[model samples]
Target: MKIVAVLPPVVELPEPSPGYLFNVERAYNLHEYFASKGHEFVTLSDAKESLEPHLADMSIFICSPFYPAYLTKELINRSPNLELAVTAGIGSDHFDLEACAARNITVAEVTGSNVVSVAEHTVMQILILLRNFIGGHQQAVNGEWNLPKIGAYAHDLEGKTVGIFGFGRIGQRVAARLHPFDVKLIYNDPYRRKDLEAQLGVKYVSFNKLVETSDIITIHSPLTDKTDTLFNRDVLDRTKQGSYIVNTARGRIMDTAALVDSLKSGHLAGYAGDVWYPQPAAADHPWRTMPKQAMTIHYSGMTLEAQHRIEIGTKAILDNFFEGKAQKQEDLIVEDGEIVSPSYKIK
Candidate 1:
């Protein structure tokens, strides 16, 4: 069987750094894994250039969110032999699930692999933006002392209402971490978690109410038709004035221009997170220089600890497939011509 893996390019170093695990050339060590099994494997760091050439014969493809190889309908139809696509970590939105299902390609990801990492990162971002840490840090680094300038915006997380969108594993973890901060928590989800709501001291609220009341709003939902651009002009306009927004989830969930406008108009005091619409955001993406916006590259889920978990989970998925075992129910995003995860939708 022929297998291919796509990953981001990594800096060349003598010793394998923690980042080596993300490099297609060094990570997964497919060569060693296949040596005894006599399977053919190839790994590529460039999807546009390297992936298309191998599609005709490839039987399986592995990729990660950090360096996603988008499997569009066109690409899916080209790879007649493709039977499976595995994500090395969580979040498989890069692939075209509709096409995958139509072509009988099983799609899987490592569920619960990096929720803690992302949840922790989300809370950190909320604190950074709420306290105006970036303004203070920039002043310090630039050899300027403006206590008033920084202090003007900085505020305590206590006594504030925070709204969480999407009540999945990561969302629940985020609420748990924030419980000790003495802030009110409200959540909006398609399904209600009455038991968890009671346990976490969180309340369920309508999406509009959450927007109007939240001092800080964080996104934890998946990217689907219902959620894509969910925070567009209309939604952002509905948010409480001077509110803060943090998105550790997918970037496409929030409209880039809408977020920028919200910040510019002072409707939102700050915006911070590590997710972006395009994985390797262009140098000139609007958010890069948007005032009062704090954005980072998509690295929240790729921490050293998360990578370790991903490595194990990815190996398990591959092993199960090769050994003819059923894919874990939670990990099967798309299987047998349909999407099984409620978080994912056809759109």
Candidate 2:
């Protein structure tokens, strides 16, 4: 059997670093393991290349959400021998799920592989914006120690109300980490988990209530039809004046234009996040120059530890597929033309 690992472009590591930015060390391991099993592994930097030459021999395709190789319906249909598609990390939005299911391609992701890593980054972004750390750091780097300018926007996280949208694995972990700060926690997930509410001491509130009351609103939801553009003009208009917003989820979750308008009008105190609507945002992306915005390339979930776990989990998923072992039902997104996960079904 032949497997093709489609990964993001290899980036030069920082000075004195021994690994590539995307970290292909695990891909090397998968190659060796699959080779020993008499399977061929061909790693490609991009998936745009026509697979007509190799599709007949390819059995499985491995991809990562960090640097996704979008598997469109046309590509899925072209791969005649493809049996399984494995997402190296969480989030399979790059895959055309309906197309894959129609073609009988089993799709699975390494669920919970990067939840802790992302949760930590979400908290970091929140602090970065709330405390005006970026502006302060920039001032220091420029050899200016103006306290008034820095202190003008800086605020304490303590005693503030934080609203979390989508109380999933990452969301719950974020709430747990923030609990020690003595901030009031409120959440708005479609289905409230009673156990989580009891354990985290988080209040379940309506979406509008969360927006109106939260001093800081952090999003940890998936990218689906319902969640796409979830934070639009109406939602932004309803938010408390000067409230900060953080989104570590998909960039499309918040309407970029609406967010920019709110920030321009001073309705929103700040906006910070790592993920973007289109990965590798264009040079003209508005968020690049938006005031009071702290944005970074989507790397929160691509930490070294998370990458290691992702590699292992992806390999295991592939191994199971080749051995005819069923994938963990919890990890299966689309199987045989049916949405196995309720999250996708309801959305």
| Backbone collisions counted per model | 0, 0
Q: C-alpha displacement of 47 in model 1, angstroms?
A: 0.5
Instruction: Evaluate residue 275 in candidate 2 and report its C-alpha lDDT on the 0 to 100 scale.
Output: 83
- For this target, which candidate reaches the highest lDDT against the unseen true structure? 1
Expressed as tens digits, the lDDT of each residue in 110-215 for candidate 2 is: 9998999999999999999988999999988999989999899899999999999989899999999999999999999988988888789799999999999999
* 256: Cα error in model 2, Å: 1.8
Off by over 4 Å in 2: 16-28, 49-57
lDDT of 1 by residue, 136-241 (tens): 9999899999899999999999999999998999999999999999999999999899989879989999999998899999999988888999999999998988
The Cα error of candidate 2 at residue 120, in Å, is: 0.6
Task: Candidate 1: give the clashing pairs.
Answer: none
Q: Would you list the C-alpha lDDT of every candidate in the order shown?
A: 0.89, 0.85
